[model samples]
Target: MDFRSLFTRKSKSSSIATQRLQLILTQDRFEVSEDSMKKLQIELTEVLAKYFEFTMNSVSMSIKREGNSYVLMADFPYSKTNKIR
Candidate 1:
């Protein structure tokens, strides 16, 4: 395999493979399944939407093991209707 050939390729299969491996490792380390993540996202979105018009597409929730504790992140834009002057 020549090093120059890698630069000529336009495919991102290498990057995809790396991402998949990291996802699996992260899940294993955190002891969380992909399904749980999806469910949590859906439920949280629903709960937030009830009170305010949330931008679901822009929301991101991730759970990862950090040190000895688990970190959970929920990021989304708040409804503009509730903005104060």
Candidate 2:
């Protein structure tokens, strides 16, 4: 018996709603506005674009809480052939 099949699957709308709720909760907990995060992501992408070729969609930024400290994480993918430096 497969335990995975025992639970009903979530609909796409439900999955999207859950993701949105999680984002809102995370932003509230970190005291950061959605606009501010977007600005930060844009600025980071612009700065990194000077040295590498990557699409804006390839960039991701999020805040994480670790013990007593809050950490900002950013991820971007760049092709080796397009490196400027």
Candidate 3:
């Protein structure tokens, strides 16, 4: 084994295919356009990033139907490396 291999650390991020599938599912379930969804995500990310530390693609947004209304749910997982200053 190469000595450098032992010292190198790899980031175990989610697969691109899985992420793409998730985006498609979210858009289809919510009846949202891909462009609109991405625009909203980016705007929200900009606002929240000012206060909290989160990875760009880690944010998940979904719409849930509740009887006569729908609820928008957003989840932003904090980044382990970026801390509040």
Q: lDDT (0-100) at residue 33 of candidate 2? A: 87
TM-score of each: 0.51, 0.64, 0.57
**Per-residue CA lDDT of candidate 1, range 1-85, in tens?**
9797779767579988987776676567657788876677788887877776765655675556689987866777776673432
- Candidate 3 overall lDDT versus native: 0.77
Among residues 3 or more apart in sequence or in different chains, the pairs in candidate 1 whose N, CA or C atoms overlap within 3 Å are none
The superposed Cα distance between candidate 1 and the true structure at residue 18, in angstroms, equals 8.7
Better by TM-score, candidate 3 or 1: 3
Give the residue spans of candidate 2 off by over 4 A. Answer: 1-18
**Candidate 3: which stretches are off by over 4 Å?**
1-31, 79-85
Which pairs, if any, clash in model 3?
none
lDDT per model vs. reference = 0.71, 0.76, 0.77
Location of the lowest summed lDDT over 10 successive residues in candidate 3: 8-17
Top lDDT model = 3
TM-score of predicted model 1? 0.51
In order, how many clashes per candidate?
A: 0, 0, 0
Q: Write the per-residue lDDT of candidate 3 for residues 13-84, one digit (tens) a residue.
A: 556677777677779877879888888888898888887776676677987668998778988887667687
